[model samples]
Target chain A: MALDKRFIGREYGPFVYTIGAEKLREFTLAIGGAVPGAGTPGEPLPHVSPLLHDAQAAKAGPYGDVIAFPSFAVVFAIRPFSAALSDPEMGIDIQRVVHGEQELEFLDVMRPGDVMTSTGRIADIYEKARMGFVVVTTESRNQHGKVVVTGTWTGVVRG
Target chain B: MPRTFQTGDTFTHVRECDRYRPIYYAGASGDFNPIHIDPEAAKAVGLGGNILQGLCTLGWAVEAVGVFVGDPGRVRRVRVRFSKPVRPEDTITFQGKVTAIQDGRLTAEISATNQRGEDVLKGAVVEASLE
Candidate 1:
């Protein structure tokens, strides 16, 4: 079934997320190929930057604090897209949905303790090649009201 | 010394999706969708088995550019199309080429391919600030 185009422009969130130092380290290591064990996010890999996991180095380096890996914004920025997928009104079959594409723009380095508020809306709903596509565009701003990140999330529903 | 970037400069990064990667990533990223954590649930959904989240692959693409620019915080943008699922034990190689440098920003095109020579991401591009 095709998604109803009427849902276009429907909005989701004001979702708020607070960046934490440990969580930022965990995400950086996990994506950097560190294997986790009980109660540990594993050792940081060589390619993983110290600015992302080491407090002292980061404090001495450029950002003056640990910085979230740019893509780490997805942790909270995904709220709106997730909401739209699970929205009963959209009737999207979760089991048949796959992330089709993603685009993210980081305007500034995200640091621990930064409070980010994100809001997104359904940008488009359409079908092609028998697959239904849902497009969601999001913008996240810091507590200072500065735009920190913008995202375009696309999900494809398999027929 | 600041690094200089030019069009056609290429870099590479490789990562293996270990058996427990999806679970670890789910814990880290808060994406616990069954298709990423439970093999049985993924099979039920006709996915054959659990798959790594597409965002993880995106992260790798960003990492490649971050490494090239010598600072993760300098990365400004990334875009990718998820063309195929990356399963456990799959090793992915990301190759990035500097495609443009203008003002203070550098743009690169990246390709993500699995051990089987299958493309997992298409039309991937990443941009980073040089200053």
Candidate 2:
């Protein structure tokens, strides 16, 4: 079955989530940020590598506190797509879906304790070679109504 | 302290995706797609085995860019197209170069490859402000 083109521009929830410091810490560690010398040897250094074991440095760092990692925006921004894709009318085959690409732009730094409201939109939906491609663009705004991050996710669903 | 970046400057960053990384990322990012956390489920779908979340790999890329810029928030834009599945135990190396410096912004082209030199993410671009 082909994805309905009418679903393009479909909008989903303005879900709200408050960032937490502990969550930020956990994400850093889960990716092995908690240990030193874990990355590929030499050259480019991991950003969070410095703060993995030292909490004090992270406090005085650029963002001035425990800030979410740049890609951490996915935590809050990805929820609405669940509701959007699963909508009965959309009829997206979830089982065969695969993430094809991702784009993230950070407009303002996101700090822990900042409540964020995110809205999801179906930016595009098309069919190619019996495959369905859907793009979801999610915009997250801080409590002050300032746009903090925008994430564009492209999913390829096999036909 | 911000350092000036010149065109042609290069840097490389490497990260390892442990066997349990997908589960951890799924927990943190709320993406429980079985392909990431279920090896058998992934094989059932012809994936051979579980794969790492594409966004997680992107996270590592952005982290590399942030490390180069010296400020995490300075990363204004990051984009990547996933070209291959990153499997557990794979080490991804991100090699980037400053392609242009203009109007106080530095632009770089980055490419990530796994242990076998397979391009996992390609056509990656990052733009950040001069620190």
Candidate 3:
């Protein structure tokens, strides 16, 4: 079944996510953003090799606390976006979909401990040569109701 | 001091995703799609093997911009199309060329290619503050 064009304007929930430091640190390390040494600066472990050079200044550098990577918003927004797109009511098949593109606009930096509420919407739907495309956009706002980031995910579902 | 960028300025950064990159990205990004984390499942689906998350590749491009701007927050906007699937152990090279720089903002045309010279990302554009 093709993705329903009528669901283009459908909106999803305002899911709340309280950012955690451990998650941030994990993402940082996963993206190779950890401070050059084996451990954070000022509190280096004695067991770490002293020959380790400061490759990327993660800890003792700028961005005081752990900050989310540019694409980290996906962790917070994917669930709600998935729920919105995979709804049986939407008549969409999740198994045949492939990510086509992405756009992210960072309005403000997201730090650990910040609480954010994310809302997802189907921005557009189009079909081409037996394939269906759905553009999902998510807007995440901070505790103060300030927009922190906006991400657009484009999924192409093969017919 | 803010760095001044001129049109045509170019820089490139490369990142090689290890065999476990997809799994780590799946865990970190919460995108556990079979094609991204399970090799067998990926092959069954015709993907040959587990592939890296598109967002993770985008993160590398963002990191390149961060290195150029000296701050990640300066990246105001990033747009890119995932032209090809990035498999594990694929070395992605992110290249950028300054297309515009005005009013304390810089815009660049970016592209990424795999070690095999295949275009993994196309029509990529990033706008960042010149701080």
Assess each prediction's global lDDT (C-alpha) against the native.
0.95, 0.80, 0.77
Error of 1 at B47 (Å): 0.9
Q: If scored against the real structure, what TM-score would every candidate get?
A: 0.99, 0.91, 0.88
Best model number under DockQ: 1
lDDT of 1 at A69: 93
Clashing pairs in 1: none
TM-score of chain A of each: 0.98, 0.84, 0.78
Cα lDDT tens digits, model 2, B1-131, are: 44778999999999988777787777767888888999999898888999998988888888888788876667888999999999999999999999999998889999999999999998999888774
Show the colliding residue pairs in model 2: A44-B12
Candidate 3 chain B weakest ten by summed lDDT: B21-30
lDDT of candidate 2 at residue B128, scale 0 to 100: 84
| Candidate 3, DockQ score (0 to 1) | 0.52
All candidates' chain B TM-scores are: 0.98, 0.96, 0.95
**Docking quality tier of model 1:** high
For model 1, residues A26-116, the per-residue Cα lDDT tens digits are 9999999998888888997899999898999999999999999999999999999999999998998888899999999999999999999
